[model samples]
Target: FAAVVGSVQDGGLPHAGCRCDNCQRAWADPAARAYVVSLALVDARGEQAAVYLIDATPDIKFQLEMVGEWLGPHPQRPQRINQPAAIFLTHAHMGHVAGLSQLSFESMAVQNLPVYGSVKLVGMLQETELWRPLVSQLDLLPIADEQTIVLAEGLSITPIGVPHRDEWGTGTYGFKIDGPAKSLFYMPDIDSLAQWAAAETVLNSVDVALVDAAFYDAGELRGRAAVRHASIHDTLAFWEKIDSQLVLTHFNHTNPLLNPAAPERAAVQAAGATLAETGMVFALD
Candidate 1:
């Protein structure tokens, strides 16, 4: 069945042109990590469907409601959070999976929600208190660097290794999802573009590649986060060498590229990719 999945990236620099308190307390000291996010993967046809969320941003309530709205008016839809089918965890970052707590008894009480991540990922969640209690409640399925897991019929997801500073889980993963009609790659938070040079075959093979466009220009980040992932993830300069239909995401609050009419857009368009928008939708067939 064809699916419509969206990664809703909301909010911006908390203080606008300056870093917020949250960033000040954090390790990298980003301007702010206050983005209200949640992604929904909808299988509209099967009636029996699934929703795979890439990163569960802090805006949990709103995001979950949005996902339900995206499901549209399905008369026979299951009235349970289990209807979401599954969730593909990208990392253990505070903003990525922090919203899982919302699925507790006070909220949806989502039991047995399949969460796919690296084995190290599972341990990380187990080691942490917030995520540990719910591990048994929600079915947390751990996969390795190269493990391929089937989400649904005709839709298989394979995680590729990528470099990153791992605080909670293994580094990061670049997913290769194959559907019946087309294939897709989601590298939301990668380190640098060079990391894919050796695996160019896989990175360039997809019809649409959702990449990591965290920084618009070099030296934007306050410290390590900025200069760190340049070689493994896609930078504006990184795109110069990449040959694919790229849609960049996991943007830093500092990325001037988020502006639709900004010069960064022009440069991104010229680089053969587009910046990912909150509601933007794309198809492969």
Candidate 2:
């Protein structure tokens, strides 16, 4: 099964300093708050369940707590939760990899935890003096584009390189996870569907796809520079003919879809696409 630990974009709900209507609602109500996008993949076929986290968001501490049952307890410290078996990163973006600091010596202090990402991403972590200490504490594994890594018997993950804003020349990847009887594709960030040649083919191949829906439309990006995320309107139109269970995630703080009462939210439901929420679980088999 895959668990959605967080559903909002990078900065999360109630963004840094914004006081927008949506942010105001989130600030006033704790229940309305959301964390950055991330997924937890669990395989419980064996005596002890194995758990893997996809994209270590800044909200990792609370996100980890959400899956504490599967993580169990730390072997050495019963009071603490055990670290995930491994973490697969989609990109080096702040939202995706910032949680690594939480696992460093100052916090979780995880030892030899396997962290996988692109060759360039892993290299940056290894070579950068600022991150060298964190790198030393982890087992950095660089995976190639389209390389499939088998986890347990029927559980495997293949990283599919995609087009996204890459300031450091480190490529972005969207994960295709194949479980025993079902498959899931997770792409939290992407510039645009039209830019990726295999967007339709790869997305349709999966049984369920949790894709990027950072903004409701271009109107949400009033004063911002040319943003790259695909709007909800565009995304729905693109996947209208696809049969896969399309779930929208990684919403920006200003997105209208975040409001349940918003007509845009109703429109999305009418289109047969789901709006992802934290703690939502999807069974693989």
Candidate 3:
């Protein structure tokens, strides 16, 4: 399935190494924007084949190489497939596709890595000077919402829209994956679940959901009480409405999760939700 944490700046990347507490006051230090690359998806045959990466995180080279190794066997032992199935993306943030350039000739020398995204996002990539150049050389494909992308007999992906900063594209989205064994809903970033109309249908249908946990408690960070990011993501107070098994991820430095023993931590556990840990893996199938 999808690979998490691929970035050069481990803290700046979403899925790699975000800790807790970089309050607004801390931003003056230029180190509070902690993040990690988040990529996810499974393949055909209900396996992690045709792995779809949600973002082309900064650590794309090493991450893809790892995916390739897992999908197939190593060169010495070789499995079944030749390459990763595909890649999907949310907004064109630097953490999302910074690895695209590395996939080009100057970097790892990988080939057309069918990257799927919304229409405007595709155009953004095309119109941009850097990623646009990759399209001319690499095989980047475009996709739309509700478009059923068939990876193979048992694996298919349908993009569902979510609201976010759209300067680079229109509405961003979470993904609904259909495989032989089970389904998963992954929305790494969204302003608020209330912003989505079909949020109920999307969350209820999946066996597991990896939702935004960029913030653990509101107003925990100094001077961030009025900031939107401080209030947007699913708060510990709002977990009761969701009916699926939840795994909170996409953490920020200000998040209380950096401390496993915090009251917020106790709150998440009492609610039956799990936290996303680095190097965590699961086989839905």
Candidate 4:
């Protein structure tokens, strides 16, 4: 099963300092709070399952518990460690890679954790003074664009380069997970649909597509400069071109789609797309 563990943008629900209606509701209701966008793939066909995470989100602690049963028992500790077979980082963004700190000596102290990312990403982790200590504990594996990493007999993940803000020149990745049953394309952060030359072809090749839905429209940006993310409006415009099941995610705090009663939700549904929600599980076997 593939679990959508978290469904909000970087900062998560009850955003750092925002007091919007949705943020207020998130603060008041624990259930309303969402972690950063992350996905976990669990191979549940055998007696024991293997787990792999798409991103090391800030909420890794809680997100790991969500899949504790599948992770099974830890070798040394009484409690199960949040150890995935490996973690395939999409990029070096705060929401995506910040959770690596949890696996360091100060916390989980996980040894030889395989962290797969671009070559530059691995370098950044090792070169950065603050993260050097944590980097030592990890087995950093470099992944190239379109390179496939086999997880098990019937499961593999390929990281495809996508256009986005590449601060360190490492670039961004949208993974194509080939499961026993079908393929899943997860493009969490992309500048625009038009920028990707193979956007249509790659999206159509997959069975499910969990794409960036950071904002609904220009209004969400308000006075701030536009972020390099695809709006739900643009995503819907290409709905008919995508042959796979579409699921929108990585919603910013200002997105109106967070409101259950918002017309944007109805519009997205009417256009044949669904919003990603925490705990939503898709079968891989």
The lDDT per prediction is 0.61, 0.92, 0.64, 0.89
- Model 3 TM: 0.79
Q: Residue-wise lDDT of candidate 3 within 144-241, one digit each (tens)? A: 88888877766778888887666644567788877677878777777777767888888889887877766655666676543334132354445567
Off by over 4 Å in 3: 1-35, 42-49, 71-83, 222-237
Return whichever of 3 and 4 wins on TM-score: 4
* Model 1 per-residue lDDT tens digits across residues 22-88: 3343225432233443345555546554556766666665555656754444345366434367777
lDDT of 2 by residue, 117-186 (tens): 9999999989989898888899999999999999999999999998888999889999999999999999
Return the lDDT, model 3, position 275.
Answer: 75
The alpha-carbon root-mean-square deviation between model 3 and the true structure, to one decimal in Å, is: 5.4
Q: Which segments of candidate 1 are over 4 A away from where they belong?
A: 1-39, 69-83, 224-227, 231-243
Q: After superposition, how far is residue 166 of candidate 3 from its true place, in Å?
A: 1.7
Cα-based TM-score, every candidate: 0.79, 0.98, 0.79, 0.97
Report the poorest 10 consecutive residues by lDDT, candidate 3. 6-15
Candidate 1 lDDT trough over 10 residues, lowest sum:
1-10
